[model samples]
Target: MSDMPPSQARSRTKVKPMTSKGTGESDTGGVRADVWVWSVRLAKTRSAAATACRAGQVRVNGQRVKPAHTVRAGDEVRLRQGDRERIVVVRHVLRKRVGAPVAVEAYVDNSPPPPPREAVAPAGIRDRGTGRPTKRDRRDMERLRGLAPKPHE
Candidate 1:
């Protein structure tokens, strides 16, 4: 048996930085998807993070996930950015904003790029200016525009 100071032994057990590369924290461990989303300037607010979860935009370890899903280093997250989704593995969890690349460093993307195409016009062409919108029409348009998440119940 070898005797060493606990502090010395603990240091050996912990992952450390190398001269050539970062401490591997970004390459090893980091933040959760929702938290990272907030940290990386993905969403405007955390509630938006949760809403993204409910909208089926986030997936973890190959399964769709909830807002509270805990993300650690190496976990993969899939998110719908707009025209396409991004699949990125967690490289680190950062609560603070790093440089854009550093903030993005915590993720890996296997997702394909979106195809370049013209914006498809919305299917239905309902004109609001033709006449004064009825109360129900107003409410429906508001709902479609997401004025309120839940309708009057």
Candidate 2:
């Protein structure tokens, strides 16, 4: 009984996906922990996020969770990478990976400031022309790294 074309009528009747208020993110229950981490750029890949979860490098609210665990908004996620840890609070849930700029907006980062440059151990550097380290040079390097004991004064 409608005068509109079939395509137009279908479009009009179509319902849009449910989205969270104010945010463009969907509100379909909750997203998986690993997927959320990867979607928000916390981990380079979903597999990496899962690996971190299995390795106990990822924790939710101070408790370790599996990769399939669901992460809801306002949950605190802590991820350990190398010698530093990243702490963030979920603001929005994402089901798919997003760009860096968009991903940054999905979480509230509360990570501690990185250690000063001086606090980190400096790597031994050799001049470009230097063929190889001499035995003495190697000994000095080991001593600097604290791998060799210092001689008694």
lDDT winner among the candidates? 2
| Tens-digit lDDT string for candidate 2 (18-106) | 56554457675788899999999989989999999999999999999999999999899999999999999999998878788988999
Question: lDDT at 7 for candidate 2?
Answer: 87
In order of appearance, the predictions have TM-scores of 0.53, 0.80
lDDT of each: 0.67, 0.89
**Once superposed on the true structure, which residue ranges of model 1 sit more than 4 Å away at CA?**
1-30, 118-153
Check candidate 1 and list the clashing pairs: 30-92, 30-93, 31-92, 31-93, 88-108, 89-108, 91-106
Off by over 4 Å in 2: 1-24
Q: For candidate 1, lDDT tens digit of each residue in 7-31?
A: 8887778665522244223443444
